[model samples]
Target chain A: MLSESETMSRFFESWRRSIFDPDIPFRRKALDVFRHQVSHVPIYARFCDTLGIDLSAESDDDNTTGSDDDNTTGSDIDNTTGSDIDPTTGSGINPPSGPKKNPAISQYSDAAIPLMPIQVFRDLLIRPDYLTIPEAVFRSSGTSGSRQSTHEIADLTLYEESCLRGFGRFYDPEQFAVRAWLPGYSDNPNSSLVAMIDTLIRHDRSGLSRFLPLDQPMHESDFDDIREQNKRIMLFGAAFGLMDLVDSGAPALPSGSVVVETGGMKTRRREIPKQELHHRLAEGFAIPRDAVHSEYGMAEMCSQAWNNGSGWFACPPWLKITIRDPQYPMELLSPGKEGLIGVADLANVHSLSFILTQDRGVMRQDGTFQVLGRWDHAELRGCNFLMES
Target chain B: MMQSDGQITRICKAVDAWLGNESGLLEQARERTISDGLFTLHDVGHMLEQVARTVTCEAITAWVEKSRDSYAVQNSGRKDSAVYDKNVLCLHAGNLPMIGLQDIIATLLSGARYHGKLSARDPWLLDGLLRLLQKQLPENVITWSTNLDDFEELRADRILFAGSEASVEPVTSRLWELRAAGKAARFLNRTARFSIAWLSGKDVEELRNKTSGAESPGLLNDLVEAVMRYEGRGCRSVAVVVAPCELSDVAGTLIPALQDYVKKYPFLHSIKPEKSYWASYLETMDRDFFESGPIILTGDTDLMGKEDVVCWISGDAMTVQQIFEKAGPKVQSIYTVENPLPLYTEALSRAQKPPIDWKPDGVDVLRWLSG
Candidate 1:
């Protein structure tokens, strides 16, 4: 048995190895993380116990053992209390509190990757005990007097590895002078999006890459200075902040400038469709609609999927997005069909790696996907990105 | 044309008969709402049932008697009574389905011309019901419009605005402008507000046992009745459930119970609230609320305004009261198993349907309307 520190260190090493190891399939790496979490993470272990998953059968062959024949999460059970009881169907998957199945391991399956619904992070910060104190805690931006979700960074370096490496795959920070117009994030020190942008700016060393003052109105002089530099520019902004620039008659950008929006419009602006918002943004920035890009991510997951000209997002090797039926959260839907999005980010080794997001999207056969805002009842307003995008 | 008390009672009787008739006005209205995707058939049936209960001859007679007995109306010779008999405009753009019925009925009972503006969300539901009343009574008794600006053109004595705080702000300013210009118009505004239920640990335990388990069918139905009263869209709907117990314990039982309720009612699963609403739901979840079937929030209570999401906070009696007090009048109702809060709190048992005599935001609109 390994000490808590050793266990966490081993998990980190496995995560680091997966970042470069091309031979290890996504499924194998995911199962390895699942085994580590089941042994070390208390909450996850309890959840597995609820699902009747045996941790001892951690080998790849046993993944198919606990696959519930029923698609439902086994939520339907009615021990009636009142006289007025309507007929209720009980087809849900029940929590396996009965005798354990001590049989041999079965076939491998992708469903074995236990998903921590994103809302769980809001209830409790699921992190390893090795680091009681987090290096940084990224909080989601919310309306006034509302609760903000926090992600404790046990290893800030690991987060940087994911954010920077993943960002590099889409846009080169060295070639572009990064200009961020994230109002809520720029003002808030506890924003992961801001922190990621900060990392990009710090590494640039060009001095031109920095946060733009979003509190004040954008002046033409600010763009004039950027245009004079004549370097390839990458402008990152929250939806509302970008809308402000657009509404204020944003100055035309220099050639090769890319505008990437993350967080949707905050309560400040009205919600427009993605196509309309992109068209308006493209018009405001004087760039082609294809040049106006988007970043699909949240504070709950360490890895991010970037949208390169197309509305569809492409994940890196370590990250994957699975579309699940909104009605039946556990059942994965076929590609091209819209449903709730489930993210399996391997980089989130310290925290729960697989997360079922409220975000609604569709996955294509080409491995690219499109986030169609949040599922029903859950708000999908603003930029659809609840975090500092 | 002015209506007598006997005439109004006759009209109410006709309206009631129309509501109960097969494929009648009420049925048509319910169908319209269901077809428009504004509410599930069960929810529309529930709200319509409430409207039917409230629009009874007995309730209207009681309101009439109460108004006649009041000093304002008795002293018609007094200068204040001169404000009666004005064209009252009803701006019915509220989130609550069939909430416009209240203002329309109030206008009729007060013996005033009713000019109503139906919200797009409600569409033809209100108009269809009103047309039924129009068939029996004078056509000039009630008038409705889709355009809010139509209210400005019609000369009026009063304007009754119904909607969210944000929705009412523009209308209030516009009405105030009219008032400033010496238009003899008084405003009766009833904006959207959230309600909650405070369950004690003992109450929760008893319920857990009575239902045979935590996820009891009856207990799940009770919770469903509270949250899904109006698809969790109405302000009067219970947006949060507070318990004076170990939060984790409450979450343990409450999560599965709500899940069962949601699973049974699949139509509710199809709803995707506005983006702004989803953001707010996420905020509540982040704070201490866990999202199961309904968003279960446990911990200290923050202000709540979102429609679809329900919050669950755990605290002792004093702590729960403090949270309730912070909610202020924004809390329309606090459904408690018993009166556990200190005196002066408006805590009551859960109502299966809407109450005939209820003051939203605790403001006596009946007194204002009757006078």
Candidate 2:
């Protein structure tokens, strides 16, 4: 039997391998979510029917064969390697050839797994049985006057494992002390910053942990404490919140202190230019501007995508990110073309990973990505709006 | 703060005047609201808060105290008077500061008998408000029950009765029979002939402003259209407008506005024609009188001065009024918007006062109906 560290490392390697290995786990998870939607979610089933895809036809046989009994399943279907062979074809399931394949496959099956609408997603969360997989649930402090949206978290153990494995690939854990400047809430049960700190304590061997005093009505004295402590900090918070601390005359930190912030600042307080925000944070913390990182994740998905100290965010091996044309949902844009960002997280076994996010982003050749805010208008295709509506 | 007996008397007189006349008028003003089964203890509380705020009371809690005192004194001689306890009375005041007192008063005046001393500290106030409001406006309130028993109860009411020609005949048969027998009854019916109207798309922002009183700009049009669609009512069934007008040109302009409204609310197609027709007929009559200039159609034009027919505009939207002039032994309630129309803010403040015998115009209608 492997040691704890060995077991952890193996999980990390498997996750990394899954990213490059056609994102099979993610696809399978997507199929599972889709199956659940068609069978249990009445609204989703009706929507699918309207789209000409008979969800009822998606049988248990299709799960194994990756083919519907009718030609309706489409041609670009890639069969799993381990699946039993079909008696008629005599060969392993291959991509359908030529014209018959192009229209049928293109029309029927999505090249990537489809995302449930926002309305359906919201409804699913309200279900008592939803996210019954014993995962931690986090709720966004809803836009003023709006209902809050609940985000189901993967098991803390799974999250810790994923975070360590993903962050370990690029940084040495032992060398850096994790210091966070997350805003503390007295009443909120599901604060992302609090969760981050909890995860850090579980993994970090460094006894040092500093929470930056950046609460509302913040004073310069809060930063003074951080500066006096004289330790490397991994500042984590919303972009705007951190910037406010810097603006309020918070002193800079040591050179090695790294800043990592998650989520977007679009609908929150006033948003500053990304470079300007970084510059102010760097000036206040006395660290390199590149040290500031931004991470992205949605309430529905389990895993997170992190920006690697640089402006670009990198997905883990088990996660696949696709940037598709905003106007055309089917057309996957090449690198450099800006469009909607779609993520397939293999770790999302309980929910859907094939989420068509409202965010606008660009895909780079290196597979790293940069987000450019949310879509100006609601996209017509996805189920995300349905959940919101 | 009083310097003389005269000042005290004047203040009392003003309060008395409001209690004796304005209160009754305001009640009458809300006749439709009450009859619609939409107003609840929370709504009454909201109105009381409005009234208390208007009176510039130091705090709503004080008003609630005064109202409870008044109620106690008024009912002291009665053997079977309802008790008013602060803990027992559920206050439905929102987060707005200085409105709690008025809400309590409104509750008392609305005939919600209370027991025990009135206290605003009760934690159940919010929950009670929500529950009562849901009960009052079940259609508007979306309910989700996690409890299996509650879910089953809700499921019984969840039968989706689809509309079709085949289904309409049987559904209306019972109602027709009751109508033929001269028995009063309410029946649910469906029809498809509705058109939504709006002043303009730009009016949406103005409509969202809480302080703005302009009949919610396009909202009046939407409401009219919704009512029309409720039973296949056409344009004539509901005449939603930015301004009440009599000119043919102004009436014609409303047609084009319907296009924009339809784009936003497609459900407008479901309005019934008869409802729209009635709404339009009423609107046309209003326009005919107001077209020459702003005019109050209620009462005789010669007897009342121009000021009497006050056209109180809230953020540029016209208020709707139903008028009755004939004195009769009529069972139906007569409703009218009062002169010097009460601002929403002011009305909410006054509602916090102690329960009084004063009847607003709308309440007069209720009294008339009950009699």
Those runs of model 2 whose alpha carbons end farther than 4 Å from true positions after fitting are A1-47, A54-111, A123-134, A153-156, A184-187, A210-232, A264-268, A327-330, A378-389, B1-197, B200-371
What do the candidate models score in CA lDDT, each in turn? 0.62, 0.40
lDDT of 2 by residue, B59-176 (tens): 3233344445555565566663332211112212112222222223333332332221112221233233323333443332233221212222121211111122222343334324
DockQ of 2: 0.01
Per-residue lDDT tens digits for candidate 1, residues B122-179, read 6666766667667666644656767655555566777776543333444655655544
Candidate 2: Cα lDDT at A61: 36
lDDT of 2 at B209: 35
True-vs-predicted CA distance for residue B11, candidate 2, Å? 70
True contacts kept of 2: 0.00
Each model's DockQ? 0.04, 0.01
Q: Cα deviation of A13 in candidate 1 (Å)? A: 5.7
- Cα deviation at B20, candidate 1, in Å, is 6.2
Best by TM-score: 1
